[model samples]
Target: MKKTMLLCALLMSAFAAHAQESRQDVSISATGTFSPTIHGATGTYTNTDTSLGALVSYRYLLTPRSGLEANYSFTQNTPRYVVPGTSDNNVHLRQQEFSGAYVYTMTFKRYNPFVEGGVGAMFFSPIKDFQTTQLDVKRTTVLGGLFGAGVAYELSPSFDIRAEYRGFLGKTPNLGHEAFTTNRYRVLSMPTLGIAYHF
Candidate 1:
């Protein structure tokens, strides 16, 4: 239809204008994930494995100093559980995070330091294998909060390398089973380094 074509043309025009102004950027990063041991009050505890992962981020600047960002991360690790004298249990899980945040940036020379805070959900899916000891466990999702502080060094008009530390606060994943339940909360630390391309 003519109307549909007109709308599509307008949308493309807007996007082209936005890209010309360098108002958006996309980043891909490698991360090192570290989670501390969590001890529950009811004699339950969890120890999570340190692992390597990846993060993808998109940002749209509302102003020169403020913007909105969306981030997705993927990591797979194992968590070992100890529940009051039961045999040790460990589950191999693929964990994912989906979050959106408000990003504030300050510029000094070519270094842009930024901070962000947001809310999201964490999903843990157990992989059935010899490494996973619990058969009854299933997938679990929990709401959580994430915060980060980092600096991006501008290499050119369209490229930069960034380093950051981000933390996620959430309840320990129990996978819908008592033996693995900690009924406690913990923080997962992610340190990242990567490059970004502006558009």
Candidate 2:
């Protein structure tokens, strides 16, 4: 974690110096986010879980109104569900994803409204102790897509506050479903808040 913070600080400093030259259309940023997933399932089970993650991104301004973004994020923690007459089940799902996106940004007097969509791959790891001791599954990689929008407020010339909502759609080896119970792959949406420095 210290290494991550140091790297981010160094990158921000580099960007700060670069911004003075010409306000480089291409900006690099690091974002730390808290994400929770709410699965659309009911009765005897619930897939409400949360995670903390970080992303490193490079955003290139394609034009005044549109741009392209590439991002890589690390997220962890699986969903948990409780069952009657059995031990509590816990799954540890960790994901590392890389995505390319198209962004439409609108600048207001003090707020910037942006919408983004992208496609990527998510890697999921499973912990079977939460389900049955006899059950063991290998990690899987799945393709996914995401879409979201957010607003950013400029706090200063170098810093900005941002809030965003994003969703991921993917499939895997029934991380939440079992033989007697089949689980469907669906989209997971998350909202995040953070700060970014533009160089």
Candidate 3:
């Protein structure tokens, strides 16, 4: 009981700190990610597919240290596949995600470190030129989770350079008619470098 109460008190304190930082401010940032794609069958295997993408986020600061963030990302990868009788082919997959998250910032003398997490939905589209038809899969409102640490070097009060490493987790249904299962869970690791501006 005591341990649980202490945990609750700590959470309350964090919330209070966030509330205190909510004030009128705006910030915009861009990020790039490189993530690998994996395919699952009787077992799981790496597809040897790597993706590169960029995202832009807008934050409405409720306080100096906390805010609400709206982010969108676009990425693409090509997976090479081989079957016993069929010719080897490459399948192209593109993804887009939109999320809303809570962001907390901590500034040091010349660097600022922050943690961010969020949840949202993702859309996946697979374009296989060798196939007669394209595969488009839409996962409805899938849960998204992100955790990252970033360093920002302030060039000015409103503009700065930031670098971060973040990981993304989500799932989408596989649209291949031949597959017995309909769901595929996606996990990615992304490192981003970009500039940010505060208003």
Q: Which candidate should be chosen as best, given lDDT against the real structure?
A: 1
TM-score per candidate, in order? 0.89, 0.67, 0.69
Pairs that collide in candidate 1 are none
Look at candidate 2 and give me any clashing residue pairs: 15-199
Higher-scoring candidate on lDDT, 2 or 3 = 2
Candidate RMSDs in Å, in order, are 7.4, 9.6, 12.4
Residue 65 lDDT in candidate 2: 70
Q: For residues 37-96, could you state the per-residue lDDT of candidate 3 as single tens digits? A: 445563433343555678777778676678788878888765444433545444566667
Q: Model 1, range 1-199, lDDT digits (tens) per residue?
A: 9999999999988876765599899999999899999888888888988999999999999998999999999999999988897888899999999999999999898899999999988999999999998888999998999999999999976889999999999999889997666788888999999999999
Please give the ranking of all candidate structures by lDDT, highest first, separated by commas.
1, 2, 3
TM-score of 1: 0.89
lDDT for each candidate structure: 0.92, 0.64, 0.63
Candidate 1 residue 138 Cα shift, in angstroms, is 0.9
> Which of candidates 1 and 2 is the stronger one according to TM-score?
1
